[model samples]
Target: PTFGEWVKYGLPFVPVMALVVGLYFYFAFRRRIQVKSLNISTLVRQASRKIGPMTRKEYITAAVLILLIVLWVTCSDRFGMGGPVILCIVLLNIFRILRWQDISKIQWEVVALYASACAMGKGLEATGAALYLADRFVAILPDFMHSGTGLAMATSLFTGIATNFMSDGATVSAIGPITVPMAIISQTSPLMVGLATAFASSFAHMFIIGTPNNAIAYTMAKDPLTGEQLVTLGDFFKHGFCILILSFLVMWLWVFLGYWRWMGFINGSVA
Candidate 1:
C-alpha cells in the first residue's frame, strides 16, 4: 500500500528525480567535492549582481522547466494533469543548484509566508466561517444545474478571492474541508469540487506575497536581464492575471466536462 501510494503520487517526480539522483552521485564521487553549507546571505549578494545570477546548469534546468511549462499549458487538455505546478519545485531547485556557493538566496522569508498562510487558513477553518458561507451559497443557488456546477464554480471563485488576501494553502485548507460535505449534499462529486478548489487556490500566485513559491522566484530573479530586485505587487499582478484566468478556465472545463460524470455530479440526488 505504501509503495502504491508512492507510485500514485510520485509519478510526477520520475524524470526530474532521476536526473537529480544522477547529478548527486556524480558530484559526490567523480568531482570529489565536499558538500558545503547552504549560505543564504552570500547567495543573496551574489544573485543580486549581473554575472552572479545563474550558472550553465541553472540556465539549462530553467530552460527545461520553461519548455515543460509551455508543453503543459498547451497539452493539459489531453494530459489531464496540471504540469507546471508539479514542476515548480524542480524549477526552483535550479536556482539552488546554480548558487551552490551561497545558500542565503534561498529566501527563508518566503518560507514564513508558506507557514503563516497555512496557519491563517486553518484558523479560518476552525472558525466555521467557510462552512457557514458554503451553506448559505448552496441555499441560494439558482435553477441552472441541479448537479451543483454553479455551486462548485462559486466555491472555487470565492476560494480564489480569499487566496489573494490570505495564503493559497490556507485558503484551500480552511474552505476545502467544508466544501466536501456541501458538494456531496448537492449530489456533486466531492472529487471534482476538490479539484476546482485546488486549481483556484493555486491561482493565488497572482500576488507577490500571496504564495511563497512566487515570492521566492521573484526574489531570485530580482537581478534578471532587467537588472533590478525592485518588483512590486503590481508587477507580479500584471504577469499573473492572464495565467490566473487561464487556470480558472481549465478547472471549469475539466470539472464540468471530464470529471463531472465521474464525480456523480450528473445525478439529481441531494443528501
Candidate 2:
C-alpha cells in the first residue's frame, strides 16, 4: 500500500534528472533571461532594504525550521517527518509565530483529497486490484521481460501520459501496484520500474488538473497586464511534451549507464 520505498529506490535517477532538467532549462530559457550584476556590498544593501532586520519571532521561526529540517533529514526513521512537523506547528502556535485564525484559513479540502487518494491506494492493494492490473500490463508487454530498457521506457511513458489526465497520486496509485509486479514478471528490477513510474508521475505539467501543484501554479499566474490567464492549456501541453521527452531520455541514459547498479539495485541476474 505504501510507495515510500520508491524514493530510496529512485535515488539512482537523481543525477540524470538534475543534469537533463538543468541543461534543458538553460538552453530553453537562456535567451529571455536577464542577469543583474551586483557586488557583496550591493547584495548587502539590497538585502537590508528588502528585509530590514529580522524580529524575535522571525529568529524563533527560523530556528524551528532548521530543527524540523534536521529531524527530517537525519532522524526520519526514528522520529518520522510528521512528528517533527507537528512539533514545529505546536511550537509556532505556542510562540505566537502562527495563530488559530491562520490555521483555520487553510483549505482542508485539499488535505481530504490527499487522504482519500491514500485510502484508495490501500484499498487497491488490499483487494488485489493492483496485482490484477500488473498481470494485464505484463501480458500486454509480451516480451518486456527480455528487454529491461524497453520496459523502463514504456512504463515511464505510460505514467507520464496518464498523470496528465489525472492527479499524480491517483495515477501512481493506479499504476504503482502494476509497475513492481510487472518488472518481476519481466525478470527486471522492481525497484527500477517503481522508480520510473514514481518519477514519471512528477512530470504532470500538461494539464491544470494533472496535479495540485500545477493547478496552484496556473491559478497564481493571473495576467497583471491584461487580466487574463497567463498560460493556456495548449501552452502547458507544448512545454510538458518537450520536458516529457527529455525526462524519458534521462531515464534511459541512467539505465544504460548502469547507475542503478552503482546504487546496488541491479545485480547480475536482474536487469
Candidate 3:
C-alpha cells in the first residue's frame, strides 16, 4: 500500500493506541503513588529520583547544548545543527565533561564508521561512480517511458534501492547533481529524483551499517568499524533487512500515491 493510504487508514487507530498507552501510564503512576516503598516520602528517595542529575560539568554541557540548539534553529540557513552536535560531543571529551571513563562511554568507533562511509561516498561521487550508473540508466530508458510518471517511479525506486548501500547524505549529495540533469534530459521533474534520493537515503537503514543509529546501537555492544562488537554481520543484516524493506515500500507509496505532489508542487494540485 502507498504510504498515504497507509497513513490515512492507520490514523484513526493511532489515537486509540495513544489513549490506551495514556491510560496504562496513568494507572501505573497512580499505583506507584499508592505504594509506600516507592512513594515520594524520604529525602534520600526524592534526591535519587531526580531525572537528570546535573553536576558542574553536566550543567556546562547542558548550557552548551542549549546554546548550540538555539543557534542551530536560528541560523539553519547559515549553519547546520549536525556539525554543531558533533563538535559539542567532541568538546565534551576535550573539556572532561565527565571524565576519561565517560569519554570512553561514547562509542567513538561508530563515529569513525559513519565518517568513513561518508568519505567513501565522496570518493564514489568524485570518481563519477554514481553518475556513471545514473547516466547508464537514463540512456536505456525507452522513449515512451522515459519522461512519464512511470519513469519517475522507476528512477525513484532505483535510487532508493541503490541508496541502501550508499548513505542518504551521500546518495543525495552525490546523485543530486547528476540525476537532476538526467531528469531534465528525460523530460521529468528534477524534484522527482531529489525526493527519491531523500527517501532512499533514509531507506538505506535496512542494513545495519547503512545508518549511524544502527551502527551506534551495535557499537554499544561491539565496534562496527573495528568489528569488535558482539553483533555479527549476519545479525545486523538480519534485523536491518526487514525494516529497510518496509521503509522502502512505505516511502515508495508516499511518492507514487500522490502524497508528494498533493502536499506541494504544481499549484497544489492532487496527484
- Provide the RMSD of all predictions against the true structure, rounded to 1 decimal: 15.5, 4.1, 10.0
Instruction: Report the C-alpha lDDT of model 1 over 1-271, residue by residue, as the tens digit.
Output: 1223223322433454345446544654565546655789988788788566577776777677777666565655555344555565556565555344455668887677667766765665678765676676677766663246776677777777778766776777677867765677677767657755765776675787677787787778775587877666676787566556655665566544444445344642222
Candidate achieving the largest TM-score: 2
Model 2 TM-score on a 0 to 1 scale:
0.77
lDDT of 3: 0.59
Evaluated with lDDT, which candidate comes out highest? Answer: 2
lDDT of 2 by residue, 232-252 (tens): 778777877887777777766
| Decreasing lDDT order of the candidates | 2, 1, 3
Error of 3 at 193 (Å): 2.2
Q: Tell me each candidate's TM-score.
A: 0.50, 0.77, 0.52
Model 1 scores a C-alpha lDDT of 0.62
Worst 10 residues of 1 by lDDT: 1-10
Error of 3 at 100 (Å): 13
Model 1 collision count:
5
Q: How far is candidate 2 from the true structure (C-alpha RMSD, Å)?
A: 4.1
